[model samples]
Target: MHQPTVQDFQSLKRILRYVKGTKHHGLPIIPGDSQLCTYTDADWASDTSDRKSITGHFTFMGPNLISWFIKEQVTVAKSSTEAEYRALSAATSETIWLRHLSAKLRLEQNIPTTIYCDNISAIAIAKNPVFHGRTKHIEID
Candidate 1:
């Protein structure tokens, strides 16, 4: 059921190479940790071709890697404001799913699942949600 094309084959080859490179990576879980925490990390603006950076993230519950995303954004952002907004949106989307997944697994989720981001503006925007000329276009809700 594999797609057949030169680009497809090349992409598969690249994926295989990456897997081969990180074959020994392991998730280290401590002995008796009960907290089911979700981690939303990012690697902004990784794409050199377009100013639209990629956001890389991974969610961990105790020691288990629950969810991850490594996709490039579609739009070209002018400032960190726009990039951080996109990153926040992406992290929030993953956090919602992580919360639902924690519930489904019968884990005791502490209220207010924290979405961690290094960007000060992103954190401010998430907290305030104030309607302003600059923030009116942010699609994160």
Candidate 2:
């Protein structure tokens, strides 16, 4: 921002506090199945300025985290369904990349990796591509 405000400083302080609290936190890779697991979510219209949702996803290889991300949706979502669908799409793309990376490493993952989502409507949209009435607003590309 061109000019920082008190609110911005407060937010910065909060972030620093969180970082301090988690200073010793670490990701642990334990012995487990070689299955890939992914979890995704979206907070519908969470951004006060843009009314856009924040999408987040975390992916795991066996018991270790391999990939994760949090992004603000560029387009404002019309509903929770749309927001969740966007999140799902992002998570799916990341899963594809992880699958390719695993193959390159000769750790060929088993087919049909699991992607978990809390939104039922997003799952439905992903399963039935022909039902475009609810997702017509989303660009095909």
Best by TM-score: 2
Model 2: lDDT equals 0.88
Candidate 1: which stretches are off by over 4 Å? Answer: 1-31, 38-45
Candidate 1 per-residue lDDT, tens place, 1-141, comes to 245899888998999999788877755445664454544444555577665777766666666666778777777666676676677788778877777776777776776666677777777777777633586665543
Decoy 1 TM-score against native: 0.67
lDDT of 2 by residue, 20-122 (tens): 8987787666888777899999999999988999999999988888789999988899999899989999999999998888887888887789999999988
Clash list (residue pairs), candidate 1: 45-53
Q: List TM-scores for all candidates, in order.
A: 0.67, 0.78
Best by lDDT: 2
Q: What is the TM-score (0 to 1) of candidate 2? A: 0.78
Q: Candidate 2: lDDT of 60?
A: 91
